[model samples]
Target chain A: MPLRRWSAAAAPLAGSPGTKQIVVARENWRARAQEIAAAGGRLMALWASGPAATGRPAPRTLYAAFVLPPGLLVLTMPDDLAHDEYPGIEEVFPHASRMQRALFDVSGWRSSDPDVRPWLRHAAWPADFHPLIHETAPTAAEEPRPDDYAFVRVEGEGVHEIAVGPVHAGIIEPGHFRFSVVGEKVLKLEERLGYAHKGVERRFTELPILEGHRLAARLCGDSTVTYAWAYCQALEGLAGTPIPARAAWLRALALELERAANHLGDLGALGNDAGFAFGLSQFSLLKEQLLRATHAAFGQRYLLDFVVPGGTRADLAPEGARALSDCAGHLAQQTRVLRGIYDEHAGLRDRFAGAGMVTPALAARLGLTGLVGRASGQAHDLRSDAPWAPYDELAPGKAGATEGDVAARVAVRFDELFESCRLIGRIVRDLPGGTHLAAGLPTPPEGALGIGLIEGWRGPVMIALEAGASGSIRRCHPHDPSWQNWPVLEHAIIGNIVPDFPLINKSFNLAYSGHDL
Target chain B: MWKTLRQIARTGIVTQPPPTGDGSLRLREALQADIREILGRALCIRVVDSGSCNGCELEIQALNNPVYNLEGLGIRFVASPRHADLLLVTGPVARNMDVALRRTWDAMPDPKLVLATGDCAATGGIFGETYATRGRLASVIPVDIVVPGCPPAPERILAGILAAIRASHAHPRSR
Candidate 1:
C-alpha cells in the first residue's frame, strides 16, 4: 500500500496515462520490489546503466517498472561505478535473474543474484569485456570462441539429456533448449538464449532520436507495430507533441491487424504441431489473405514501417479503409467457423488439453504475462487496464481462459483473434477525419526520460527513452513481455513428453529476437 | 467429420503459379530441366537465422503457405544441413552465431549453394557491422545469391529459392 501511495505521488509520464515513475534511493530498491511482489504486482522490466562509451557521464543505475493498480510504477536506483554491485530483485520476481544476468553482460554491473553465468555474452566478446561500459578494457581472449553454457544436470538412473537448438530444426529464431529427461518424460528443462543478441541496446545510442523508430520497428518482426508505436510514443512524449485523432485511430487499426495476423499464424502452427495439418492450411490461407489486404491498405505486408514518430507515416484513404474493413469482415466470418472446428476436433483437443500445463499458482510465482498470462487466469490486459488514446475510445474487450494449458492458450488466441477482427471493423468505420502525421517537432531536452508502454500482440511492449545532447539518443531499452513468459515455459514443459515441446512452444510463441536483445 | 470435409470442400486448392518473371516459359522449363539433371529429386533447403529480427523468417515460412507452395515446386526445407543442397541464411551474422553458421555450412554435402536472403544477410541491413555483429554474412561464410529487402515478400523469396537451385549446378550456368 505504501509502494502504491509512494508511486502515486510521483510525477506522471506521458502516453502511460495511469503510470507514474520516480527515482528511489538505493537502500529502498530491494524493499520496494518486495512490496510490489507482496502486493501482487508483476515486474514489467528490469535494466541497468553504467558508464557508457559515448556522450553521457551518468553513474551506474538500476531501473525497474512494476505493473500495479495505478498503472506502471517505474523506479530508479543509482549505484557507484567503482565495484559495481547492486541488490537483486530475483527473489521477489523469479524472472528477474535472467534479466539481471543480461544487464550485467551488457553493462558490467553485477547484481546480488547468485547465478552469474553470462546470459547474452556467448564468448563472442571477451568474458570480462562488457559492451555497454565506457571504461571497459579487453581483458582476455581476442578470437571469438564457442560458449560452453553450463546446463544444470539431472543425475539419476535412466536420466538423459536432449539438447536442442540455437540452430533449431524449424525455420525459426535461434535459442538453445536443454531437456533433462528420463526416457520420454522431462525432469527439467532450461533454455539458454541470447544467441539472437545483435547488440540492440548498444546500437540504440548510435541512432538519432527521430530515426530510433526504424530500429525499434525491427525489434521483433511479429510485434513491429507495437515496438514502433511505443518508441514513437516515448519520443513524442519527450518532445511534448500531441498527435492527431486520425493517427491514433490508424495506429490502433494497425495494432489490431498485427494481433490478428500473428494469432492466425500461431493457431495454424499450433494445429500443425498437434498433427492437424488442416488447421495449418486453413489458417495460413486466412493469414495470407489478411497480409495481402494489409499491403493494399497500408504500404507493407508485415507493417514494418507504417508507424513513425508523432503519428503514422501516411493516412488511410476511404477506399483503403473500406478494403481493410472488408478484409477483416471476411476473416472474422471464416475464423469463426474455423474456431468451431478447432473446438470440436477430438484428437487435436486430446493433444492440446493437458500438454504444457502451467497452473495459475505457478504462473503468478514465475511472473507469467501477456496473452499467455491471460490463459493462466492472470486478468491483466493493458488495453483495458491502461487505455491510451484510441484504446480509451475503443475500449476493446479482454479474453481469458483459466485452464493454463495448450488448450487454454489456444482458446485465448481464438477469442483475441475475433476481438481484434471486430476492433478492426469498428476502428475503420469510426475513424475521425484529420491529418495523420504530426508536423516535424523540436528535439527533446537532454537527460529527459520518456517512457512509452503499449499493449502489443504479445503483451505490454515498453520503450524507455532518454535524450542525449543535441537530440542524440543517450539510451533506449525496448522490453518485450517474453522475458516474463520464457522462464514459465521451462516450468510448463515439466513432466511432459519431448514430442509435445513444439506444440507447447507454438502455443506460447515468445519472441526470441526481442527478449534476447 | 462431415463438417471438416465440407469445410475442406468449400476451401478448394488456393495454390497457383507464382509470379517470378523468369522471362519466357521456355526459360522456366529450361531452368527446371537443369535443376532435374543436377539434382534428381526435390531440392532440400536449410534456413539458418544468424541474428535476424524474425522478419525474413516470417516471409520464408510463408513460402510453404498454400499460395507460394514451396514444397509443391520440388523444394523443401529440411532439418539438418547434411540433407540440404541450399543453405538459406538470414540476418546480419551475429558474432555468437558465427561458429554455428560455419558448422552448419560445413555439415552440408559438396556442391552446395548459399543464398543470403534479406538486406541484413546481404549487407548487415540496419544493425550493421558492430562489436556484437559481424555485418554481411559473407564475412562468416561464402554467399552465392542475395535476396535484398528489409524482408523480401514470400513471392520474392520463392523466386530467390528457385534461382539458388538453378545456380547450384556445378561446372556452371555462367560458364
Candidate 2:
C-alpha cells in the first residue's frame, strides 16, 4: 500500500519542490490515499470527468489532489472497472468527505465510505438522471421531484434548527446552511450547497478549444485572472508551447493587481463588518481606483479576458504603466495610513480580536492555505511555493501571521497589498519588450495530462487538464481553495454571536460557485 | 473630519461622478440611435444567471444601488418570461445549468434580446470550458451584446445595460 516506502537515496527526485512524486499501484489506491493522509497530505478535491461532458460516457476518470506542506500531490483513477468504493480518507481528514460524495454523484462511481448524501445534485432534475454518464437513454421528461435531505439530527432540550439560504436578505450567492443551536449558542452548523449549481462539468464537452477559456475565466469571477491563467497553463503545457516572456510578465502583473484590488476591498469589508466604516470607505475607494487603473491598462476592469490560451490580449501602454505606478504609489501610502487607523481603533479592535478565530493548530490540521491560511499561521503561497512563470525569477516569499483572528486576516490582506504593489512596480520596471501573445496553439499530443497551479485572490487554484488527440478537451478538474476553506468557516463561527456571522464569513470570503462547479 | 479631508486631498481623487442619465454624450447618441431605430417605449427585461459567483448579481441588484438608480432608465429585470422583452444572463452556464439555461430561454417570449453580462457570460470569459462548463452564452443561447469583464465595473455594467437596451430597440425580433 505504501508502495515501497520512499528510500532516503531517492529523496532528491522524490522531494523536489517544483513537483513531488508519490507512487501508488492501481489496486491499492485507497490504501495509498490512507498513507497520504497518515503522512499529513490533506485531500483537497475530487472530480470525475471523461471524453464527453454529456451524452454517451467513455471511461470515467476520477482525479483527486492532496495538499502537502511542500506543495500538492495528485492521483488519477480510470474508473472503468468495477472496484470496491475506496475507503474515504475523511477519518484522517474531514475535508475529503464532500469530495468523495461529489465523485460518486458526478461519475456513477460509488464511495465505500458510509457518509453519503447528494453533494451538488439538487432535485431540479430527476433522481435517476445522472448527467455525467456518457450514454443517455431516451425517456419522457418527468416532473421534478422534491428532495428530502436528511441532515444529521441533534436531540437536546431547547435545541432548535435555524435554516438560512441558498437565498438570503443580503446580496450573496445561494447556499443553504442549517445551524443547530441552543438559544444563542451554535451547537452544530451543516451546509447544503450547489443551489446555484450550473452543471459546469457537463458543459465542457460542448465547447470547442478556442471558446473554452471563456468558461474557465468565469469559474470564480473574483479569481478570474488566476482561473484563466491556470486554464491557459494547462493548455500551453499540453501543447508544449511557451508563452512570450512579455505576455507572461503581463499576466503576472494582472494577477498581482487583482490580488491588491481584492485584498483592499476585503480588508475594508472585514473592517466594516467589525463596525469600522472608515476602513470600508478607504479600502473600497482604493479598490475602485485600482480597478480604474486596470481598466485603463486592460480595457475593462476586474481584469477579465486579459488572459487567453496562448497569452494575454491587451498590452500595457507607456502612459498606462505610469498611471498604474502612480495609483500603486497612492495606494501604498494610504494603506500605511489606514493601517494606523485599524491598529488603534478600540471599538473595531474589540469586535475583531479573538472573534471567529482559527487557531494555528487547527489551521495546520485543516491544511488551510492562501491568505486565510497565512493569517492563521499556515504559511503557504503558490507564488512562493510553486514558483511558476515570472514568480521563479521574482521568488516572492509567503506572507503569514500567527494570530488567526479577524485582525490577522485584515493584517494578511494589508501585507499582501503592499507585496502586490511592490511586485507590480518591479514588473513594470523590468517590463520585457516582446510580443503579448504567441502564435496559434499547436494541436495536443494523443494523450497528455498537464497540471496548472495558480494563486488566485482567494487561494491556490489547481487545474488538471487531460487532452485527447486533435486538440479537444478530454477531462479537466478545476479545484478552488474554497473547498478546503469553507468548512473552516463553520469551525470559526463556533462560540461567536449569530449577528457576527457576516463579518467572519466575509473575512474568509470563499467562493461557493467555484467549489460547487 | 480633518483627516478625511486630508485623505481625500492627498489622494487628489473624488467620489465617482454623480449618476448621469446617459453615461456620456456619444453613449447617449448610441441610446438615441437605438431608440430611433426601434422605439422609445418601455422594454421588459429578463435576468438569467448563466453561472457567476453572484458578485455581478450584487452590483446588478445595486442597479437599485441608490446612487446608480437603474430603474430610472426603464431597465427592468422581470421575473417571468411572458413579460420579458430581453434576456440578461450571468455566470458561465455550468454543466448542470445547461438544461435550466435552455429552458429559461424557451420560457422567454419571442422578439427578446439576449444580453450576456460579465466576462464569464460573454465568451465563457474566465470560467472557461472545463468539465464543468457547457460553453459561452453564445454557444448555447443566442447573445446580442457581449459585456466583457470578470465582473464589469458598475459604470461599465450600466453602460452594458444601456447598450443592451439600445440593441433591443434597434433590432426588435432579431433574436
Candidate 3:
C-alpha cells in the first residue's frame, strides 16, 4: 500500500479506518503533502470550505484529500483571511495550480503558487469579492466586463496563435482553446474553461441536504447517474442510512446503462471525427436505441435526477428489468460486430494510432485517473480498487493499453462498453428483492462530514458533504475527474496537428461544466 | 464499404414516421409550412448553448440521428449564424457566455428566429439567476418560442424551432 508513518502532529487524524479527517498545522501541511507525494499518494481533491456556522470568527479551513489505496486521507489547515495565503502544493502536484486558483477565486484564500491567474473567476464579479465567503451575498451583480485571460506565450519563428471559443460550432458545452501553432503542428495548447460555471457550489448551500442530490445530478448531465449516486452515497454515509440491496443493485444498473450509452455515443463521434460518417450513422442509431431502452427502464432517457439521497427516487420494474436485459443482450451482439468493423477499418486505424499520445510517465506525473488513465497504462478503477456494495460482488474487469494514443482510448472504451453490458446482465439476473427506497433519512449530527467516491463513466466522481444543523448543507464539493484529465489534454495536443486537436480532445472527452462547477 | 452497403440494404430505412397526421402532426405541418413559406425551401438553423448542462445538447444531437433524421424535413444545422435562419438556444445565460451568446444572435442574418430549448433556457431551470448566471434566454436576447422540459425531447425541440419560424413569419420585423 506504500503507507508511510505519520508525524506526531498528524497522529490525531489517523483514527478511523475507511475515511479519516485530520487537521494539520499550517506550518506542517506542506511537509505532510510532500511526504504523501513521496509515498506515491495521488492528490484526489483540494478545496477550501466556507466559514464555520458557529459564528465564532474561526479561520476558513483548506482541505486536501489524498488517495491511499483502500481509503482516502483528508488533511485540513486553517486559512485566516487576515493572512489570506496558504502554502501551495503545486510544487508537489502540478495539477493543484488550477485548483488552488479556483480556491483563491471563490474563497479568498490565496496559494503561494507563482501562477496567480484567475481560474473560475473571469471578472464577472469584482476582484475583491470572493463568492464562497459568507459576507459576499449571492445578489451582487456587476456590469459585464471583457475578460483578458493571459495565455502563456510560446514566442519564436512562425509561432502563430489560433483562438477557439467559449461557444463552439457544435452543440457541446462552452470552453475556449488557444493553440500556438507553427503551420499545421501545434507548439502548445492552453484551454480556458469555466464558461459554464453556474455557481453550483453556492447553490448547494441554498438547498436542503436531502434536495442537494438533484443539483448534484445536474452537475454534469452526461454522468448524472454517477454524480447522483455519489451524492447519495455521501449523504447516506453522513446520515448513517443503510440503503437496501435492491436499491444498490438498481443504482449499479442505472450507472452501467449510462456508461453504455455514453460509450456508444463517443464511439460514433470518434469515428466521425476520423472521417467515417457511416460509423457515425450506425453508432448514433445504436446509441439512440440504448437511450430509448434507458427511458423505458428509468422513465428518463438520460436518467437525470433519478438517483436521490437515502436511495434512488425510483426502482426498475420487472418489465423494465426485462427490457433492459433484452437491450443489453442485443447491444452486446451489435457492438461486437461494430467493434470488428472499427478494428479492421484501415483508414480509422491510421488516424487513431500513434496520434495524441500521452506517455505513461506523463500520465502518472499528471495523476490522470479514470478511463483516460487506464488507456495510458494507469489501471485504477474504483469499482475494483475500492469496491462498495454491488461492485464488491460483481468483480468487473479493468481495461487498459500501453499504446496511450487515440486508438488505445477507443479500445479502452470498447472494452469498457462490453464489460458494462456484462455487469448490467449480472445485475439484472441477480436482482435483489426488497424495498427500493430507504424508509426515512435521519439527519446527521451537526458538523458531520462524509465523502462519497464513485467511478463514473468518465472517471471517479467524488462528493464531499458537510452537514449543518437541522438538515442543511454547510458545504458540498463535487469534484469531477475532468479536473485532472483537462490539463492532460493540453499536454496531449503538443505535437499533434491543429486539425487533429478535436479528435484528440474527443478521445479524452473531459467535461467542461463538470470542471467549471 | 460493400459490407456497409449490404448491411444498409438488409436494414432498409429505419427512420420514424414524420410528425404528420398524428396529435403533433398539425403543429409540425404548420411549422414546416411556415418555414417553407419564409425561406422558400430548406430552413437553415444554428444552435447556441448559452450555458447548459449538455442534457439539452444530447437531445438536440439526437434530432440528427437516423430515427429523427431532421435533415430530411428540410431543416439543417448550419455552421455559421450568418447563413442560419433560426437560432436554437439552450441553457440559462451564464454571465461569462453572455457576450458570446449575444454575438451569435447578432451574427445571424436577418429574418432569423430564436427558439429557447429546455427549462433552463425558458426560465433558468435549477440554476436560476445567480452571480455567475443571467437567468433565462429572454433576459439576454429576444426569444420567439420556448420548449420547456428539464431537457425537452427532440420532437418538442423540433416543434419549438418550427414555432419560432412561424412567429418570425407572423411578426416579419422580429429579425
Candidate 4:
C-alpha cells in the first residue's frame, strides 16, 4: 500500500523542499487520488487557484498535496473553465469535503462533490460575487441576511441540539459548534467555521512577494514562526536562494521555542480544565519565563516577523542564545518533575485517560493528522519524515502514543517538551557562522511556483506561492493542519459527554484564524 | 501534593508592579466620578473576536497569568455580554462577524466601553478593508482606545482596558 516509500530519491517538485509534483490530466484526477488513498497517502491540503489570482490567462487549477510514506507529493490539474468544475477527492479523503467547499468559495471553480453547502460565505457577500475572481468586493456596510445554512437534524428521543458559538464564553477565536446530544452524551457534533475569513488568499495577489512574510506571520499568531518560515521557504525556493547556515539553525531554534511555549500553555490549560489550578499557575509561570527569554533572543515574544525571505530577520547574539538555551534547559527540568506529578495524580489521570478517544482506525479513516494523529498511532512528523536542513542534521525524536485519549496527547506533549528543549540547546551550542539574511536576494520570475512546507508546532504548516508579473505575489495559499483535524474532532467527540468537549478541543488546539483565512 | 506545594512555594509571587489605573483615574475627576457612580471598581469585560489572526487573543489570555494577575486588580472577563461593563474586542471586523459584533454590542447593558486591542482591531492591521472584512473594529463599533502592536503585550492590553474605562467615562455614550 505504501507508494514506493517517502525517500528523497524521488525527484523533488521544482522550488519545493523534497516534495514531488505531478501534473495530472483532469480525467485521471479521481483515479490518481484513489491510488494515493489506497497507498496510505495522507491528504495535506486541497486548494484551487484561478486566473484572477494568478494574473494569467490560463485556466484555473486545482492542487492536492499529500503526505505519502516517503515525503510530500503534490498533484495539480488544470480546470475546464467551460464547466468551472474539477474532480473531487472527498470520497477518498473525507477531510477534503470542507476544503472543496472552501475552494469553491475562494475560487469561482466548483468541485465534483455532491454536498455543495457554502462553507466560508455566510450570507455576508452576494452569492454570485466570488472575491478572488471578481474585481469589486462588497463593503459589508449593509445588514447581512440571517444564515439559512441548515444543520443536519438528528431526530430521536431526548436528542436535543445544543448550539455553542461563533462567539464562545472564553477569549478564543470564533466558530459555531452544534451538538445533538441525548442527556449528557453527544450523539453528533457539527461545526460551522470561516467566520474569521478576511479574503487573505485574494489579498495575497495584491502584495509584493517580499512583503508577504509579514502577512503570513499574522495568519495565526502562535504558529507565527512556522507560517513565516513556510512563506519565506516558498519565496526562497522560487528565487533559488539557499539561506545561510546560521539562519537555518536560528529558524529551527525559534520553531522549537514556539512549540515548547505552546505545549506549556496547553498543558496548563488542560490541567485547569481538569480542575487543577496549581498546574496552570506553575506552567503559566514557566511559559512566561520562556516567552521573556524568547523576546530577549529574537526581539519578539511570539516571533511574528523573525523568519523573513532568504533568511531570518536578525542574527542571534551570543548572550541571547545563552539566555534561550538556559531557559529551555530550566523548563525541561521543571517539566520533567511536573510531568511526574500529572502522571501520578489519580484524579487528573481519570479525567484525562478515557475522555474523547479517536481510535487509530478512526484516525486513519478520517485523516486525523499532526500531534493529535501521533497520539492516535498515525506516527508522522514532518521533522523526521521529511527533514530539511537543520532537521536533516539534528534528527528530532518523534514522540507518539496509540492510547488516542487526552492522557496520550498529554504524554506526547511532555515528550515533545523535553525533546524541544534538547533540540534548542543543540541548535544554540552548535550555532553556525553566517549572515542572517541572504545577500542580494533575486526575485523569482513570473509564473514560478514554489511551496514551503514545515513541521510547525501545530503540524505541517504550508505556504504555496507562485510569483506573479514583476515580482508580485500571484496566488498564495497558507494551509494550516486544522483543516484536516477539525472535522476529525467531530468524530472524536461522539460518544463522549458534552462537558468534556472543551478538554478534547484544547488537546488539539487547531487554528481557527489560519483555517478560516 | 508535596511536589505541587513545593513548586508553588518556590515560584513565590511573580506579580510585580501590578497595574495601577492611576493616571487615567487622576486625568479627569469627572471621569473618576462617572466610574464611581455608574460603574463599580470591578471592571467586567467580554472579549469578542470579530475576525482576527488571534495574536491579540494570546496577549488577552496572558492577562490571567500570575505575572500579570489581571484578576487581582478586580478586572475579570465575563461569560455573557449582559454581565459585562466593557467589550474588549480583537481582530478586524470580518463581514460575517459584523452582524454578530453589532448584536453583541446591542446585547451589552448600556454605559459600556469598547477597547479595541492590537493593530488589527485598531486599523485592520495587515488584512485591511477587504471584500470579506470591513477593516478596523471602530468602523463597526465605537472604540475608545486602541492598544497598538501586532499583538500588544499583556501589560499594554491591561493599560488599554484602564484607558478605555477612563476615555469612555468622559464620553460615556461612545458605546
- Compute each candidate's TM-score over C-alphas: 0.95, 0.81, 0.94, 0.95
lDDT of 2 by residue, B93-132 (tens): 6555565567667877766667777767776654465444
TM-score of chain B of each: 0.84, 0.71, 0.82, 0.84
Name the 10 consecutive residues with the lowest summed lDDT in model 4 chain A: A1-10
After superposing candidate 3 on the true structure, give the runs of residues whose Cα lies further than 4 Å from its correct spot: A1-3, A7-17, A52-58, A80-82, A134-143, B20-36, B166-175
Could you tell which candidate, 2 or 3, scores higher by DockQ? 3
Fnat per model, in the order shown: 0.78, 0.23, 0.68, 0.80
lDDT of each: 0.86, 0.70, 0.82, 0.85
TM for candidate 3 is 0.94
lDDT of 3 at A278: 78
Q: How high is the lDDT of residue A333 in model 4?
A: 93
Runs in model 2 with CA error above 4 Å? Answer: A1-17, A20-23, A51-58, A69-71, A78-84, A135-146, B1-13, B16-51, B55-152, B159-175
lDDT of 2 by residue, A44-64 (tens): 667766645443436656666
